[model samples]
Target: MVLQGMAAFRIICVVLLAALAGASTAQRPTYRAPQHTRAPLPVGATPEDFVAFANGGMQIERDRAPDDELAEHRRLVSALDGLLPQRKGMVDAYVVSIALDSDPVFGREAREAAKVLARRYDAAGRTIVLAGSDGTGPSDLPRGSPGHLALALARIAELIDKSEDGLVLYTTSHGAPIGIIYNDADQGYGAISPNRLAAVLGALGVDRRLVIVSACYSGSFVPALANADTAILTASAGDRTSFGCQSDNDWTFYGDALINHALRKAQPLAAASAEAVALVGQWEQQGRLKPSLPQVLIGDRATAWLAQLDRRTPAATTASVGRPATALLDQR
Candidate 1:
């Protein structure tokens, strides 16, 4: 009897070990190298040439008049036309929402957030959206190229009263420790570094500012963008990544919680951020993922501006019924 029992126990142990090994092997990701390598462009190649090269050499022989440059110029004109007309007396908030990635998910989230803010502030002329098309044409905003973003900010500065008005800038994209990824696939590749962003804001003289960066490692932006007159919020800490960035989803985890859920209720920006953080914590815990630890830094001088904005538009407890439920998937 004892010998039989020992044999059964050994069989069970072997089965368990084999199952663990199979699970480990299944968890390992597969990688593939690119099939074709790009040829280097000539030293004096124009920006158009570079774009053509990057886009698999298709646009090299395209006509110049009806090409990318013309399209970009028309897009810029559309963006400028979308900016809110400056008001006469009371301090108003102008929002410029940008989706820095080419992904459809970022574009959708950015457009939705812009809609919420515009409705909250009654800012028909005060809101501008810069995002790539998601095929739905939510706002028909311009592509969020780096140059376009800079131009938008400069234009906004010109349209608003610098001292009295506030700028709410929201950007959503994939990020690395170095900076936020700026890629309009086939158009170009670049990054928006913390210093560069700070310089843009400073140069515009838009002192009362609210900057929300939704991306992995977005906390890196806090140090440079945070100032006495600016309030900054990030989707994750410098070392972490947030979830739910799939193309099919309506909103990301942070975007769903913060803009879709919390901010839709007309709460203060600080309060909305806190609520979003708590909600994100719950979502991560439920999914058995590590905490994203969304970060916020509201400078002392920015608090008064935020308070005034809040007073002008009181908080409503009503939730937004338009947004879809937050998904649990993660795609970086």
Candidate 2:
């Protein structure tokens, strides 16, 4: 958005390529269909429909909220403008965490993930969180939607130095072969495909980034988001289902392992990711659930920024808090 001219064109071109190529590996898993426990998923949607949606985003006619509610939502989204500019001449991390669905589980995960990431990246003033209510009283934050995500990225693009600053994005939601599903019962429904996400990041000129997507079929995003300067981690493989998405829960299987446990320490991101993957594997095995096969890819160019952020990481470890992800399994 900084240079809306050529950059917008490039984003459009990328989306076109994704639609024409239809390269997303996200598959509707055979084990369990995404349902209404946590978030409403596109139960019967196909991958082709997903690509088409990615090419031309949803134009849903959302039910109108009260005038006061609308104003409040706008105020919350506008809060992105309050984020501080990146400290010049330093390699800073700009953390953006969003809960894509209104499922209280995602909202909870996104809220904590934002804090965990902010601490790890030393992004105190550079962090922006967009999440709905976590079912714990009223929320002051705005809900995570495709539109808000774009606004957050665009604002970061304006403030951060493209070459010097890095982005750490965490998106938690339900999924389909399509992508991350955004279902707010009161608001409406939509989707964010891998290509659309890739295009937005590319258009923003944010090359150094660490993107974590937590949802079923999340691995499908890897191919589209992969870049020489990027690192990516997902909750599951293209056709797999990640567990622990109950609405009353605090974290998804991926979030509990990666953010609540591994990331609360003084360590490199790759090491934390490794530990998380192992934890998820053990959980799935014990529960006799399908393997999510969470995926992680760190490019050669990512090392520089990773090192910089690792240096900023706190030396002490934070004890894991709240309900455990395994609680979901016990309930079942």
Candidate 3:
């Protein structure tokens, strides 16, 4: 059997290649606004805002945001009009990938992950990505935030036929025990607790879905989202933490093992997940760091939809790319 518990050995490593990624923001909102009335980060936020979040708490006040900011957000959200409708009689997969933090690492991971997921699920025009500038040229894609995620899900719901179509949602961010965090550099602070996410999906009726969350303490989402028709994968258990969130790196430990390595092959989710967990455990041991204890939950009813999506993944696996996450930890 695979190792049972595994994450916290950073003390021995001379090279602090990455900081322990920390989650940001305050409590989740009690009620969610409708997609039409959703909001994004303010156009102008002071560095002090980031300091506040760094200090462990911030009440995001984008509700009184300026007109121009709201206008820009509207344009970005409106761009989702390009998400093509599903062809009748065929099962469709809509991929939504987002980087909740402004860290370039998450941006790179989220962008590439969208491509991988889209190709795997055959979701060409059915894909939507939300991320911030990673020192790359101007991008029309809106920054990741709770509002935009809600908007994307709501839009996909309209286009996808609930009977057979599915949603592949991938999120990369620093997670707290509370939930996956929503932090954009200095502004847009909040957490998407399991309850909140469960409510949203339950409300939208997006039953056939695959959600992969990369963040510390991400497994906490399992109990809420797990069901006969849903599959959930997390980088770490609810109390443990993951690695390779260094802002400068290309992939987090979990991202590299799962997406860049295991999923690249035409294997079943169980095999891929097993490979990823093994890789993560190996790295944690090598780095003398505690294991993040990656978690996976596959419901029985999800097997059919998973098989359908698996049939379309690339025939040949791609060569692994990017710096090794453990090496980053090894470097001083």
Considering every candidate listed, which one attains the maximal lDDT?
A: 2
* Model 1 lDDT-worst window of ten: 31-40
All candidates' lDDT scores? 0.68, 0.77, 0.74
Model 2 agreement with the true structure over 132-155: per-residue lDDT tens digits: 766654457876778888888898
Please estimate how well model 1 matches the true structure, expressed as its whole-model Cα lDDT.
0.68
Off by over 4 Å in 1: 1-68, 135-139, 314-325, 329-332
Off by over 4 Å in 3: 1-71, 137-139
Greater lDDT among 1 and 2 belongs to 2
TM-score of each: 0.76, 0.84, 0.80
Clash total of candidate 2: 0
**Can you rank all candidates by lDDT, best first?**
2, 3, 1
Predict model 3's lDDT versus the native: 0.74
Stretches off by above 4 angstroms in model 2 are 1-47, 59-61, 66-69
Give the per-residue Cα lDDT of candidate 3 at 184.
58
Error of 3 at 116 (Å): 0.7
lDDT of 1 by residue, 1-332 (tens): 01134443343233223222211111112411111122212446444433333222112212234566677688778768777677778667888888876556677788888988776655667888888755343325677766677888898888888777788888887664445655554344455667678777888888888899888768878987887889999999976877766444567788888888888776777888999999999888878889989999999988887777777564555465433435434421
